[model samples]
Target: MTTNAAMQGKAMSVEEEKIQGGVQSLEVGLTVLDALTAHNAPMMLKELSEVLSMHPAKVHRYVVSLIRKGYAQQLTDGRYSLGERAHAFGVNALKRTDMLELSQRYIQDIQQHLNCSIHVSKWFADGAVVVQSLESNHVFNIITRVGSRMPLLKSATGRLHACFQPEHIIRPLLEKEWESSAKPEQYPANWEDFLELKAKILSQGYASVTGDMMAGINAISIPVFNFTQQLDHVITCIGTEDQLPEGQMQQAIDYVLGVQRQIDALFHPAAAI
Candidate 1:
């Protein structure tokens, strides 16, 4: 129901606001890059200037800076595309932001809501290592410190990592830990039982431990998948039977699952599975 004059007025107002609030040269330079991005391919100077409604000389000036700063590349064929630095900037940005750092807020929320100790662990070359934690107010003495490395076959966090990891990556570490932990009997005598436990953890999207890693400690762990749809971090809720109780176990699992889903949705909506 709007007239052409009204739409013209709105467009002019937006342009006026942009010119008033933004640096003129920077805006023009960015617009040149924007045109290239929209085209999503190499473009000749005349084509770019025609699309942008600007003189070729002015477009060349902006493209020179873009190429110098590595935001855009001029190919040997005289066409342009996004430069290596532009692509690396995006990948490095994702790398610099740590998963545990983002999950800390969620961990604190879980602590406040459940009043149970929480541990955040990430997979390393060897195994899962605890990186952050919130102690339960009840405080029944937790021995696993932040730097503690969890057992692959025994601990909740380790089991969750093991469940999602390929066998080639986890098998050697498990064999090494199993040989050294001095708990030979604890390693399922039948290899199939271990496989079944892993299958169950993967199927349930979480794993539970009842005093396997540490005596009197019962914990549940859920994996957080990154944008690559690979398990990158694990969050474990820790408590004893006296604190978590048998009847409330599933409730705790449900809570941890909810937390994992929120993190997955927030950071990797497109990769969510």
Candidate 2:
């Protein structure tokens, strides 16, 4: 006689095994969809079967089901490609992706690799506001925080924004900073000086500052643009002079720019090409 507890245990074991082993048909369907996306063009039945290493009849059955569900379409030439439904699904997913949320993992990866503080900033009505930050274990007493508004001319992140953002949008902020700055002499002395600084930052495709925002601190910043090709955010890495000396600056810059490329590729895939 099986006890009630023993029967319950047997049922639980079966349920656990079922959960571990997912539906294989769904996995195969997703693989077919992924292949279509990778090919990025219409494919004949034979081509898809060859790519997926599956029997033509089986692939055809899946393709037919996908067509019925609107996940794929058969072209007039009998080749298959992603359908309107798939496109709509992708667009909807992108619409819900927040830049800061999407970038959190990348930011943490860089921080761990470089063992320095990293932050991301977005342009607000007033200036570039730090929206996210990751601190390094080795660094302490860093001043920048989530709400910190970086100085346009005194910080690497600010300088990058000044260089990439529209002139009309940033000019007023620049003037305001200049007027309110206690040590105006530390910034560009004249319009020509400011232009030279801007040109240099644009030419280099990034911005760097040494002991500008704080004594003995160094930083490098890169820009991330959205699908519309507008400056969406800036990522900056901060470290003490000893940790990011001239010898190691190039490596830090590479790590920072690598994250920028990843983000740009995600949002602006065409520009990457």
Candidate 3:
């Protein structure tokens, strides 16, 4: 015979299972919203249904629920688009977006994989400034700190900025750097040489230095662009020549480029979709 206590325990277990699995209706409704968001324009019921691979009637039901919640809306022509509430949500999210915070996990991943120190730099009023640094497990002392300013022509991080940023923005800094450089002969001798160097860096999609910034230290830097395709940040990996040799340069570049693509996708989700 079934006991009353056993029945109640069974009911509780089913309830817990439902909680763990989440509300299916809510999930479906959010999927509808995602379809609209990714579409980035008003979509008809038939179009959205096709995109989600669901029946039109079922898609309309979820769309109705989203409309009631102000996450979506219907136009006079019966096309559906993101609502005012959804726009506000996206605006708020953009306001809170921080490049340094977004790159932290990727930075840690690369440091662990390459066993090399990583530096993240952002352009300040003067030039590229190190905003974040992560040290590898190896016992070498990395001289770059959080507030250190990286040179425009002398460091890999700086060259990356020069490659992507507007010529007007970087030209003054480049001239000043050339004038102030202790070893002027080591850099491009004239404006034509500077242009050629920039062209080469752009062609390769990254900049690199060996025993240039600091004797014994080699570094590679890649640029990260925002949704509007502006230079957002520069990520640099540093190590001794032995740690990152010429033979292994391509491997390190691949790792950094992978992270760069991820960050780019995050900034430009519509393009990614």
Candidate 4:
């Protein structure tokens, strides 16, 4: 007694349901990966379950599958972190021809020249992320790791981005972060001071932070511009006060600038003017 129109409509509805059902498992798996990524560190099973608001048993099942697929790994302590496959994917992402592969040699050259920790950050929708890093041979251990998010109003790279990027693109993000802080007074004393700092960074073509994130540690950040003169990536040099001596500041700055010039020559040759 089913009419032809009713049969066609039922067929279409069934097809839509099937399509949605097909992706449900994949979507759940990705949700697990995303939660781990946001943590940026290894987490225990119960802790991860709490964060995801899922039952421990369910999370365990997903984690086991992820481990089998090499997307996640279980540490000796039974904590879970992103495994080899995930890191390999990140490395591959960084090595894309337009960015890391082209600049890697320069990064190495700068590291060898300064003998300090070097960080390369790329702008993301949320903020800057450390995509690559090189550790120096010195005993000083700078603990920054890849996938770490940069502070918008605090870190040297964050301030550099604020200076080079358009106000429309950067202001809202800054305001949101400011509002999130339980202590708003901790930010620049006033808006004028913040603007002034941005101006200074632009004029100097770099920004520096000393003992802000970590006591006795210091860092200098320089911007890289793409062919369109837009912000591309930021290079940050980090070390203790002794490692980055006051006398060597200019030399390091000059070397970093030279490297930026070389990158611009290749990536944005016509716009390098």
For TM-score, the strongest prediction is 2
* lDDT per residue (tens digit) for residues 1-273 in model 3: 889999999999999998899988888888889999999789999999999999999999998888888999999999999998898899788657786678778878878888888899988887889988888777774658999988877789888877766778888878887787788677665567879989999887889988888888889998877646778888899999887776788989888888777887888877766
* lDDT of each candidate versus the true structure: 0.81, 0.84, 0.85, 0.81
Residue-level lDDT for 14 in candidate 3: 100
Cα lDDT of candidate 3 equals 0.85
Query: What tens-digit string does per-residue lDDT give for candidate 1 at 177-216?
Result: 7667676688443456679887777888898987787777
Q: Which pairs clash in the backbone of model 2?
A: none
Clashes of 2: 0
Cα error of candidate 2 at position 42, Å:
1.8
Q: Tell me the tens digit of each residue's lDDT in model 4 across 13-128.
A: 99999987787767888889988988978999999999999999999999999999999999999899998898888767644547666777888888898889999998888788
Candidates ranked by TM-score: 2, 3, 1, 4
User: What's the lDDT for residue 121 in model 2?
Assistant: 93
The C-alpha stretches of model 1 lying farther than 4 A from their native spots are: 1-23, 28-92, 180-187, 271-273
lDDT of 1: 0.81
Q: Model 3 misses residue 190 by how many Å?
A: 2.9
Give each model a TM-score: 0.66, 0.74, 0.72, 0.58
Better of 1 and 2 by TM-score: 2
By the TM-score metric, which is better: model 2 or model 4?
A: 2
Error of 4 at 228 (Å): 2.1
Question: Could you tell me which 10 consecutive residues in candidate 3 have the lowest summed lDDT?
Answer: 184-193
For model 3, what is the alpha-carbon lDDT of residue 74?
98
